[model samples]
Structure formats: C-alpha cells, structure tokens
Target: MLVVGGITRLTQSGLSIVEWAPLMGVVPPVGEAQWQEAFDAYKRYPEYQQLRPTMTLAEYRFIYYWEYAHRLLARAIGVVFLVPFLAFLARGYLRGPLLRRLLLLFGLGALQGLMGWLMVASGLVDRPSVAHERLAAHLLLAFTIFAVCLWTAADLWPTPAPDEGARRRLRRLHAGLVTFGALLVLQVTYGAFVAGLDAGRAFNTWPLMAGGWWPPAAWRLDPPLRNLLDNIATVQWIHRTVPLLLLLVAALLVAGAWRPAARAGGPHRAWSVALLAGVLVQATLGILTLVTFVPLWLAALHQAVALLLFGVWLAWLHVATRARLAV
Candidate 1:
C-alpha cells in the first residue's frame, strides 16, 4: 500500500479523482457515461487545465485508475484489519493496554483517510498539484500510522529478555533511535518539497547540483530563508545531505549495540543489525533514485524502504524503552 501510494504521488496521479465520496467513490465507473462524467470532473481541475493540458482521455484514465485503486486498497486494508481486530477483541485476545492501543491504531487509520483526501483537495482548487507541506503531512501521517501498527503488533508478541546493565545502554540507544527517526521524517518531508518543486529534474547529477558543489543561485531567493523551502536546488541539497547524517547515526547505533559493556544479545542484536541493514538499503535506494532521476519504480521502492526502516527503528525504541523503565 505504501509503495502504491508513493507511486501515485511520484507520478502526479493523485487528485485525478477530483472528489472525495468515500463510499460512493469505492465503486468505480460501471458504464461509459459514468466514466465520461468522472473524466469531465477531472478536466475541471487545475492539474488538467494548466499542467496536463495535453493529456488524452486514455492517459487521464490511466492516472484516474491509479489513484482510485490506491483509495480502494486503503479501504480494503481497513476492512481486512478491523474485521479480524474486532473478532480478536470479542474472543478476548487483546487485554488492557493492548486493547486501548489497537483502538488508537484504528482511530489513526481513519484519520489518515481524511488526511489523504485533504491532500488531494489541496490541488483541485488553484494549484496544479498538492501543496508540498500538505503532501508531507499526509505521507508522514501514513508512515506514523504504519510504524505504530508494527510497534503495537511487536509488543503483543514475545521478545528476548534484556540483561540488567544492557537495559541502561539500551535506553540510550532508544533515545538515539527516536532522534534519528525524527530526522528521517524531516528528511522525507523535505523530499516532498523537492518533488513539488520538480527539483529532482534539475540536478539529475549526484555529488553536486547543476555541476556546482553548491548552487549559489539557490541562496539568492527572496528573504534568503525562502530558498530553504521553495528553491529546488536547496531542497535537493538538504534531501541528499540529511540521509548521510542518518547513515552516520545508524552506524553509531550498530557500534553501540555491539559494545562489550552493553551485553546486548538476542532481540537487541537483531534490532541493531536490522537498523544497520535497513539504513544501508534506504541510503543506497535514495542514491539510486536520485541518480536515475527518480524513476517511478525506484522512487516507489525508495519510499517503501524508508517506511520499513522507520518501522524497525520504532520497534527497537519501543522495546528498549520498556526494558529501561522496568529496570
């Protein structure tokens, strides 16, 4: 689902629906008349009028189906999750804190649907695309919900016991992971700006922006600070550099987890190893996505890997923090 959602954003397929009829929208056009009505509504949007003026009915259909399918899949996932969840609750599978957490997860999932539509609505009015800020908010919310679900699920299962001294060190590791995870989110948010501004198309080259170590032109925008948010070059630079910082942090975490004093073993070692592997894969995917100028497949893969990496870090922190508190 994350992969498809990322593709929809990367391909500018979002906002193709032009309406948010959650229940009604679930059923796609059944006849030619209904399909034309949907297409006509899309024609009225700024994306069609200004940005995609050359788009044919066939091409329009392509994008519409992608977005529609994405929405439908989300609805399906909700049903798949809620049905089993209710059954489990009825059978008393969830207890105390776990039940409360599952309910919270359900609420978050519902809110994410609303947030997705809010993002789509941003582009239907005056803009040719969704606002980057809103896009980031939508993606971040989805990723957050996903991470929470994974963490909650992990908590419900058994994990290896933490040794006494290892607990203190694990607490420190947990804090670092939380900080790193937050930074990863900020980086992803900046990536939304990069996408919104079509920044990736500009650089098209690694290690530099437009053959310069630093695009001096990026800094010359209005009020200077605006460059950080709006300038394509600046946004791309930040996106590239932030991951390097995350890679460094991930390496440090791996080393810390392996230290003799830490007594880290079992789940601790597994999480540390997973963290290191995920970060490495994510960083490599980021570079490949950039070098390839953000092709649809690679871009989607990059986004999926990022969410998975975030999940790993979230799980690591959740377990480590609980062990620390128990000490």
Candidate 2:
C-alpha cells in the first residue's frame, strides 16, 4: 500500500479520483460509461485543465488506476488489520497498556486515511500538487504508524539479555541510537519536502548544486528562513546532508556497541550492524534517485528503503531500550 502511494505520487496520479468514497470506492469503473464518468469528473479539476489538458481517456485511466489501487490497497490493509485486532481484543489477548497502545495505533491509522484525502484535496484546489507541508505530514504520519507498530511488536516479543560487562558501552550506544532515530525522522521529513517541491529535479549533479558547493538560490528566498523549508535547493541540500550525518553517527553507534570481552555478543551490536546496512542502502538509493532525476522505479525503491531504514532503527532502539531496562 505504501509503495502504491509512492507510485501514485511519482506518476502525479493522486488527484485523479478527487472524491473520497470509503466503502463505495472499492468497486472500480465497470464499463466505458462509468470510466468516462470517472474521467470526466477528473477533467473538471485543475490537474486536467492546467497541467494535463491534452490527456486522453486512455492516459487518464493510467493515472486513475494508480490512485485507485492505492486507495483500494489501503482499505484492504485496514480490513486485514482490523479483523485480527478485534479478534485479539475479544480474546483478551491484549492487556492494559498494550490494549491502549493498540487503540492508539488504530486511531492513527484512521487519521492517516483522513490525512490522505486532505493531501489529495490540497492539489484539487488552487494548485496542481499537494502542499509541501501537508505532504510531509501525510508521509510522516504513515511512517509514524509503521514505527509504532514495530515498537508494539518489539515490546511484546522476547529479546536476548543485556551483557553486564558491556552495559556501559551499550548505554552509550543506546543514546546514540536515540539521537540517530530523531535525526532520521527529521531527514525523512525534509525528504518529503523535497519531493513535494520537485526539488530533486533542480540540480541533478552530486558533490555540488548548480556548479557550486552551495547553490546560491538555496538561500535566495525572501525572509531567509523560509528557504530552508520552501526553497528547492535548500530542501535538497538538507536531504543530501542528513544522510551523511546519519552515516557518521551510525559509525559512532557501532563503535560504542562493540565489546571484545563480552564475546557472547548483544542486541545492540547486532541491531547496530543492521542499522548501518540500512543506512548505506538508503544513502546509495538517494543518490541514484537524485542523479537519475527521480525515475519511477528508483524513486519507489528509495521510498521503500527509507521506511525499511526507519523500521531497522526502531528495532535497534527497541532492543537497546530493553537492554537498558534489563541492566
């Protein structure tokens, strides 16, 4: 469902549906008449009149299906999750704090649906695309749900015990991982801003932007501070810089978690390695997506890897927290 969302955004297909029919929309257009109806409705939007006035019904269907599939997939996921969750709750499988947390997760999922529509609606009015801030909010909310789900699972499962001799080192590693997670969230937020602004297409060159180490236009926006969030050049610069910072912090985390005497190993050590691997893949994918001008497949891969990276870091934090509690 998330990948479908990414594809929808990349194809600029998000506003095709224009309406939010939660239950009724599960059924697609049945015939030419219905398809024409759907297409005509889309034609009334700014996306069609301003951006894609020349789009044919055939071409419209291409984008329509992407948005349709994204919505349908989301509904399917809701059903898949709700059924099991209700069953588990009825059986008294979840207790007190866990029950409350699950309720919170469910609420966040529901809120995410509304936010999705809000994001799509942004493009339906005044502009051909969603607001960058709303886009960031929508993307961040999705990841937030994903992270919470991982967190809840980690809390339920059993993990290896913390090594007594290495607890000090593990604590340092844990702190670093916490910091890393915060930075990762900020980086991902900035990335959404970049996507919303079409910033990746601005300067395709690496190691520099527009033939300079620091692109002049990055800070050229009025009021100075708005450039950090609203300027394409600055948004991309932050996107590039954050990963480098994460890589450095990850190295420090790995170093802090290493213990020669423990020999038995620890969760921090294992998770640190996994976290580093995810960071490397994300960095490479980001560069490839940027240099290639954000091709559909590469952009989709980058989006998928980012969520995966966030999951890995959440897992690492879970284990590290458990180890600290054990100590």
Candidate 3:
C-alpha cells in the first residue's frame, strides 16, 4: 500500500480522481460512462485545464486508476487492520500498555488518511500540483505509521539484552540515525518541490544543475529562505547533496556496529549490514533517477527503497536500545 501511494505521488496521479469519496470511490468506474464522468470532473480542475490540456481520455483513465487504486488500498488496509484488531480485543488479545499502544496506532492511521486528503486537496486549488511541504508531511505521516507498526510488532517478540556501555553508544547511534532519516525526508520533500515545479524537466544533467555546479542565477532568485524552498536550483541542489550526508552517516553507523570492542554482532551486526546495503542501494537509485530524468518506475522504486531503509534503521535502533537495557 505504501509502495502504491509512493508510485501515485511520483507519477503525479494523486489529483486524477478529483474527489475524496472514501466510501463510494472505493469501487472504480465500471463502464465508459462512469469513466468519462470521472474524466470530466478531473478536467474541471486547473491541473487538467491549464497544464494537461492535450491529455486524452485514455491518459486520464491511466492516472485516474492509479490514484483510485491507491485510495482503495488505504481503505482495504484499514478494514484488514481494524476487523482483526476488534476481534482480537474481543478475544482478549490486547491488554495493558500494549492495548493502549494499539489504539494509538489506529488513531495514527486515521490521521494519516486525513493528511493524505489534505495533501491532494492542495493540488486541486489554484496550483497545478500539491504543496511540497504538505507532500512531505503526508509522506512522513505515512512512514511514521508504518514505523510505529513495525516497532509495535517487534514488541510482540522477545528482544535482546542491552549492555550499559553499549546502551549509551546505541542511544547515540539511534539519535544519529533519526537525524539522518529526518534529513533524507527533507531531501525527499525537495524532490517533491522539484516535481511540482517541473524542475526535473529543466535540469537533466547530473553532477550539476545545469552547465554549472549551481543554478546560473540562483542568488538572483526569490528571497533567501523562500528561494531555498521554491528555487529549482536550490531545491535540486539540496536534494542531491542531502543523500550524500545520509550515506556518510549510514557508513559511520555500520562501522560503529561492526567494531570489535562494540561486539555489535548478532542481530545488531546483521541490522547494521542491512542498513548499509539499503542506503547504498538507495544512493545508487537516486543517482540513476537523476541521470535518467526520474522515470516513474525508478522514482517510485527509489522512494520505496528509502522507506524500507528507514524501517531497517528504525528496527536497528530498537534492538540497540533493548540491548542497552539488558546490560
């Protein structure tokens, strides 16, 4: 479901449906008449009228289905999670703090749905695309819910002991991972800005924004802070460089885990290795995404891999903290 949502964002399909009918929209258009109605609604938006004037009914259908499926999957996940959860509660599967946590997770998921709609709503207005900031908020909220689910699931299982000294070190490592993750998320946000502004179409070159390392007239653009947010060159530059910082932090984390004295072997070692590998793959994908001009598949794959990597690091942090507590 996360993968599909990421794909919808990458393909700019979030606004294709033109409505947020959580119940009725769960079912896709069944016939040509319904499809045209959906297409007509989309055409009423500025995105179709101003930017996609040449779009055909077929192309509209393509994007419409992508978004519809994305929303439908969200609804399905809710049912799948809630039905069993209620049954479990009835059967006394939930108790104590765990039950409280479960309820919180459900609340977070609900909030995520609202956030998704808020994100799509931004695009349906005067702009042809969603606000990059709102997009980032939506992505972060979804990932946060996923992370919480994974964390809670891990809690259901036994955890390793925490060494006192190792606990302290792991705390630092966890903090670093979180900081890097936040930066990576901001980078992704800038990627959204780039997409919203169609900046990718302008600067297809790699290793530089254009013929220069920076936009030729970057400083001449908007106000200093606003420029960083809206300037294509600035946004792209940050997006490109932030990942390098993440790679460096990830390497340091792996080294910290593998050091002989740290004895970060066992689960911690395995997680460290996985973290390193995920970051490396993500970096490679980022580069390819740039050089290839952000193809839908590669871009979607890149976003998915990033979320996976974030989950890995998050799990690693959990285990590291537990190992600390045991010691």
Candidate 4:
C-alpha cells in the first residue's frame, strides 16, 4: 500500500479521484457514460484545470486508477485486518494487552484514512499540489502504524528475563538504540518532507547542494524559521544531512556495544552493525534517488528501505528492552 502511494504521487495521480467516498469508492465507474461522468467531475477540480487541462478521458483514467487503487488497497487493508481481528476476539483468542494493541492499530488505520483524504483535499483547493507538511504528517502516520504493528508482532514471541550478565550487556545498547531511534524518526520525517515538496528533483548533486555545502539558496525564505518547512532547499538539505548524523550515531552505538556483545557472544553488536549497514544503504539510495532526479523505482526503494531501517531499530530496541516491554 505504501509503495503504491509512492507510485501514485510519482504519477501525479493523488488528486485524480477528487472525492473521498469509501463505500462508493469500491465500485469505480465502469460504463462509458459513467466513466465520462467521473472524468467530468475530475475536470471540475483545480488539478485537471490547472495541471492537465488537455487530459483526454483515456488519459484521465490512467491517473484516476492509481488513486483509485490506492484507496481500494486501504479499504482492503482495513477489511483484512478487522475481519480476522473481530473473529479472533469472538473466539476468545485475543485479550488483554494484545487486544488493546490491535484496537490501537485499527484506530490509527481509521485516522490514516482521514489523513489521506485531507492530503488529497489540500491539492483540490486553490492550489494544484498538496501542502507538504500535511503530506509529511500523512506519511509519518502510516509509518507510525507500521512501526507499532511491527513492535506488537515481535512482542508476540517470548521475552524471558535476562541474567545479570545479559542485563548488563543490554544496558550497553539501550541508550544508544534509543538515541538512534529518535534520530531515525527525524531523518525519515525530513525524507517525507523532501518528497512532498519535490525537493529531491533539484540540487541533483552529491556532497553539496547547488555547488555549496549549505546551498546558499536554502536560506531564501524569510524569518529563517519559516524556511525550515517551506523552503525546498532547506528541506532537501536537511534530508541530505540527517543521514550523515544518523551514521555518526550508529557508529557510536557499535563502538559502545561491540566489546560487551563480543564478550558475551550476544546479538547486540550484530544489530548495531546491521543498523550501520542499513543506514549506509539507505543513505546511498537517497543520494542515488537525488542524483538520478528521483526516479520512481529508486525513490520508492528509498522509502521502503526506510521502513526496513526503522524495523531494524525496532527489533534492536525490543531486544534491548524486551524484559521491560514484556511487563
């Protein structure tokens, strides 16, 4: 669903549907007259008039189906999740903390649907593009739901009490992983910001932006603070820079955890090592995505690897603190 979203945005199909109709949305316009009606409705929106004024009906269908499929996939996810969830509850299979967590996921999923519509609606108004901040929020919410689901899935397995030596080993990684996790979240949010603002399309060079370290153009917006969110150069520059900082944190984590983990022959250092590698690969993908002018596949790969990197962090953090989490 998330990757499909990347395709939708890349195809400029996000606002093609123009309306949020969860129930009626399932059955897309089928007949020739119905299809023309749907196209007519879309033509009334700013996206059609301003961006694709010459879009033929066949061309309209191309973009419309991407958004249609994205929304359909969302509905499918809800049904797939809720049906089994309720069934398990009725069968007395889910209870206590597990049930509460599942309910939380369902709630977040509902909120994500609303956020998706809000994002699309942003583009339908006076502007032809969605507000980047709202797009970031919507993407971040999806990431949040994914992270929580991953945590819960991991917790379904046993987390036994560690011996004192093992506990001490875990202590070595706890602070580092927590700090890395926080940094990862910030880095990913900036990534979403870049994508939403289409910042990666510019400054198609590595190591510098527009031939400068900070891309002097980054400071163009007034009040410096406003530039943080509204300025494409600033947003992309932050996106490019955060990974370097993340690499530094990951390095420190390995340096701190290596000795104890090797002595104990445990998994702590392995995760730290993997974290570093994941960050490196993701950083490389970001650079390539930019240098290549944000190709769809590369950009989508960047986004997917980001979730995978977060999965690494979640797994490491869970392993580090599972005893406490189990409680």
TM-score of every candidate relative to the true structure: 0.92, 0.95, 0.91, 0.95
lDDT of 4 by residue, 67-175 (tens): 9989999999999999999899999999999999999999999999999999999998898888888888888898899888988998887766665566655565687
Taking the tens digit of each residue's C-alpha lDDT, what string does model 2 give over 209-323?
A: 8888888777897899999889888888899898998999998877766756434256567877888888999999998898988999999999999998998888877776777
The lDDT per prediction is: 0.83, 0.87, 0.80, 0.86
Better of 2 and 3 by lDDT: 2
Candidate 3 shows a clash count of 6
The Cα RMSD of model 4 versus the native structure comes to 1.8
**Model 1's TM-score against the true structure:** 0.92
Cα error, candidate 3, residue 226 (Å): 0.9
Clash count list over all predictions: 0, 0, 6, 0
- Descending-TM-score candidate ranking: 2, 4, 1, 3
Per-residue lDDT over 1-327 for candidate 1, one digit per residue giving the tens place of the 0 to 100 score: 888888888878998898888888888887888888888899898998998888887888898888988999999999998999989988989889888888888998899998888888889889898878787788888887887788777777875555677566777687778878888888889877877777777777778777888876878788999988888878888998888888888888888788877776667778888988888898788778888878988888888788778878888888787787667
| Predicted candidate 3 versus true structure: per-residue lDDT over 1-327, tens digit per residue | 878987787777889977778888878888999888988899999889888999998998888888988988888889998999999999998899889988998999889889888888998889888887787778778877888888888877886555557666576666776776787667767766766666766677778776777777666665678878777777777777887888888788778777787676677778878987887898788788878987888887887887888788778777766676677
Clashing pairs in 4: none
Query: Every model's Cα RMSD, please?
Result: 2.0, 1.7, 2.1, 1.8
Q: Please give the lDDT score for candidate 2.
A: 0.87
lDDT of 2 at 279: 94
